[model samples]
Target: MESFADLSHFLRSHRLRTAPAETGVSTGAGPRTAPCLLPAELARAAGLDADRYADIEDGRAGRVSLSVLHALASALHLDADDRAELFRLGASPGTSRLRGLGHLTRAVPMLPVIAFNHRYDITGWNLPGQALLAWDLDWPVEHVQPNLARMLFLGRATRALYGNGNAHGQRQVAGLVGALRRAVEQHPDEELTRLVVELAAGSREFAELWARPAEERSDEDDCGVLFRFEHPAVGLMELSRVVLEEGAQNGEWAVVFSPEPGSASAAALDDLLARVSGRPC
Candidate 1:
C-alpha cells in the first residue's frame, strides 16, 4: 500500500527533526554527536531492537503492532494529530478509536476558535470565530460548507483578510500551498485532487505556486503564524494563530487566535467576545 511509504516518510521526517539531546539517547562509547537521531538511536529510545525498527522504517515490516507503534510515537514526541496519523498509517488503516471531538471548540468562548481537517474543511467554529472572521457558520441549504483553502483562493473577501502582495502574503500563500500538497499526499482522493485542479485553473497565483517544486516551497506556518487580521469591528489586530491537533483521528486541527495580554488587540478581543457572549454559535 502507498500508506507504507507515507508512514516511512512521516516517521523519517519526525525522526530527523528529533535530536539526541531531546531523547537523551547516549551515543555509545564513541565521541560521535550527530544532530538528529539515528535509526538505531531511535530504536534504542523506543526500547526496540535495532533490526525491528530498521525493518519498520524501511517498510519491510507488515502490520506493525499497536504497542510498537505507541512506543515509536512516544519516542518521536508526536502530538495528538501526529500520533493519530501514526496510528492510522501504522497500526490500523481504517480503524480509529478517536473521532468527533470538534465540540471542544465551543468550550473556549473567549477566543475565536476554528476546527478544520487536513482537507481544509472548516468543520466547526464558535460564535467568536464566526464574528471574528465575519463568516456565517451556518450556511444556507444551497450554500457550500466553509473551507479555508477555497476561501483563501476563491473568495475575494477572505483573500483580503490575509497579507497582501508582499513577503508576508507570499509566505502565507506558500504555506497553504505546501499544506495542501501534503494533505493530498497523505490522503489521496478525488475531492482533494479536484480542489487542486480547480484552484490551479481559477487562481493564477495558486497555479504559479503549485507549479513550484515541493522542495523549493517552505511551510513556515506548520505550527502557527503571526496573523494580522483586519477585523471589521475591532479594526487592525495582530493575533498569534496557534494551531493544535484536536483529539481526533480525522486529522482535525484546532486553530486558536491569541493576542498579547494587556494589548489593545487583547482588549478589543475581550470587547468582541463580550458582545458575542450568550449568542448562538
Candidate 2:
C-alpha cells in the first residue's frame, strides 16, 4: 500500500525550493547553504523524531498522525489549499468514499467536453467531443465503457489519435498513468484492480511505468494543458485542455478541449468538424 507519496514529494520539493532564511533557519559560515533543510532539521522543526520524518520522506512511514501533519504544515508555512492537498495525499486509501455520478449536467459547446467518474471511467462525452478526440462511435453497446488509462495505454487507436508514438503522445500517456496511480492509491476498488492487472498483463509500457512510484512520475496535468496533436484529418493542431470537476467527493472531472483561437489549429478544427458532421451515421 502507498503511504503519502504525493505528500512527501510535495514536502521535499517545497523544502528544497525554500531558502533557509525564509524559514528562519541559519546557514552555517564558510559555505553557501543549499537553500533547503536537511531531513533532520525539517523533522526537528515539525516536532517529529529524525528517523520518523526520514521514513515519511522515503515513503517507508506506514501512516502519520494529524498532529505531525499539522506541525509539518506549520513548519513549512503551507497555505490552505496546499495544506488541503497534503491532507488528501496523506489520507488513508480506504477514505475514498466517492459518490456515483448521475449525469454530466453541464455543457460548453465552444469546447469538446467529456466527463469521468472517480474510477476514471469515461461516463459521458459530447458530440464534438467524440470528433475532437477522434473516438470510434461504433463501439458496440454491449461492451464496458472506455477508460482513459486503458484507452491510452492499451488501445491501438491512441497511436493514430496522438500521432503514432510521438513524444507528446508518450508524455500524455505517462501523465494519464500518473493520474491513474493517484486514483489507485486513493481508492482500492475491485474493478480498478482488475483494470490495473489487465493492463499490466497486456501492456509492457504500462506495466513498466506503473511500477515506478507516483512521486517519481511527472506531476503534470493529465488534461487541461496545451498540447499539439498531429491529426490525420486536421493536420497539426494545438488545443488547450480544461478540466472541470463536478460534485464534492464524487468530483466527476470533465475534460474540455478547445482549439487555440485565431490560429491555424482553430481553422483546421473548424474544417475537420464540418467534414465529420457531413459524414453519414
Candidate 3:
C-alpha cells in the first residue's frame, strides 16, 4: 500500500506533467497549439527565481513558503478548498487543521449545503441541499455519491441544468484535481489516490491539467463561480457557487447555489422544485 509520503511524491509528479496550454492558458497560442509554460514563466508568476521554483516542485531544495504557495495557487486557479488543502500540505502535518474548520458546513443556514471530501465524495448535506437536488436525505452517501464534477459530466440532467455548462464543468474538474493533488501530498496512504489516477487517465483534459502545479485562492473569494442553469420548469437560470469546508477529513466540501432574488431564475427554481415534488413553490 502507498503511504502518505508516496502519495505526496505521486501528486508532485502528476502536477508537473500538466502545463499551461492544457488548461486554456492562452497567450496568443493557436487553438491547435498547446504551449508549455517553462520554469521561467512559472517562476515569474510566483515571484521566484526560475531555479528556485523548479527546485521546490522537484522536491530537491527550498522550503515551501506561504507566499510562494499563494502565488502558485493563483496561477493555477485553484478554488478555496483546494487552496486550503495546499496550505495544509505546506505546513507541518501535525499543524494543518484549522480551528473551527467544519463549523460552517455543520451549521444550517437558509441555503442548501452539500459537503464533499477531497475525492469529491458526498459526506453530508443539510436539509436544503437535499430539497434543492430533490434527493432523499435518508439515502446512503455512497449511493448518492454527490460529486459535482461527476454529476455534471455524467448525470442525465446536469448539462440541461447548468448554463455555461462546459466552462463550469471544466473549472469544477480542475478545482477537484487541484484539491486531490494537495491531499495526495498530505496523505499518500489515502485510498482515493489510485482512484484519482484512474479517473485522470480517462480524461485528456484532466490529464493535461493534472500535470501542472496547482493554484490556491481564499475561501471567501473562491466561493462563487459564475454559471447558468436550465430547469424543465424554470427554462434558464444564472447561478453561482459558495463552497464551505470542514477541516481536513480528505473528502469534505460544501457547495451551495443562489439565483438573484425576485429574478426569473429564482422563480423558475421555485417552480421547478414544486413541479418535481408536487409541492407549492
Candidate 4:
C-alpha cells in the first residue's frame, strides 16, 4: 500500500541505485566507494546544485523542470515508458471547461471518451469507450461503476489488461483515496462520505491509503498509467493512459495509445478503431 510519496521515494531510490554505472561515472575510491550514487552525485551528473535537486526529491518543492527530470531519466537509462512516466509526474494539470457541470456528465472528443463525477461514478461514455471496455452500450451508465480505480482492481478485462496489475491497482487506489480526502476536507456530505466508506469497505488497498492522512497530491498533469492489453483477435499491445479533466464536477477522460509507431500493437489498435467505427478492420 504505497502512497504516491512512497512511489516517488521508491523511484528516487531506484534511480540512485542504478545511476553510477549507467551514467558511466566512477566513484574514485576512498570514502565514496559505494556502488550507487547519492542525491548529490546525481545532481552533479545532471548539472544541477545538489541541494536544489534534493529539495525536489524530498517533496519540499512543487515544481520540477522537465528538462531536469529528462536529464536524470537519461542518466539513469530508463526505458521509454519509464521515462514518460517520470516526465508525467512533473507536469501540472491543465484547467478545463468541463469543471463545473454539476452531477451530469458528457463525454468529450478524447479517445475512449468517458466521463465521471467526483465520486468516480460513470456518467457518460462514447462508442469508442464501449469498444475499449468491451461493454454493452445499451446499458444505463448508472448501472456501471465507472471508477477507473475500482475497475482496475475489480474488472476482469481491466485487471488482465494491466500487466503489473497489483502495483498499478494499488497506486490508482491510493491516488483516488487521496482525492477523496481532499473532497472531504472542502465539503463533507452524505455522497462523498458514503463513497469513501464504500471504497474502503470494498478495497483493502484503498482502505490502507485512506487510513493514513494523504500525502501531498501528485501533479495530476504528470501522472500516467500504462496498460498492456491482449485482444482476442488483435494480439498484444501497450497503452499509455492520459487523464484529462472536463468540468468542475471532477469529470475525467482517459485516452490510451501505443508509444511506438509502426508496431504490431499500433497496427492492431488502428484496425480495431476502424472496425469499431464501421470502416474496416
Please give the lDDT score at residue 249 for candidate 4.
Answer: 45
Model 1, 118-209: lDDT tens digits are 67765445556666765433421112335678878887767766756767767777788887887787767787888899999989889998
Q: Which lDDT tens digits does candidate 2 get at residues 114-193?
A: 65655666555544565665445452111234576777667776556776667887777777777777777776678888
Which candidate model has the greater TM-score, 2 or 4?
A: 2
TM-score of each: 0.57, 0.56, 0.48, 0.46
Candidate ranking under TM-score, highest first, comes to: 1, 2, 3, 4
lDDT of each structure? 0.69, 0.63, 0.53, 0.53
For candidate 1, the per-residue lDDT at 39 reads: 97
Flag regions of model 4 displaced more than 4 Å.
Answer: 1-110, 134-145, 153-157, 163-169, 220-236, 249-260, 271-281
- In Å, residue 9's CA in model 1 sits off its true spot by 41
Cα lDDT for residue 88, candidate 4: 40
Candidate 1 vs candidate 3, lDDT winner: 1
Q: Residue 110 lDDT in model 2?
A: 39
Better of 3 and 4 by TM-score: 3
On residues 83-155, what C-alpha lDDT tens digit does candidate 4 reach at each position? 4344445532321123222112122222454444555554444444545655322322223235555664456
Q: How many collisions per candidate?
A: 0, 1, 18, 9
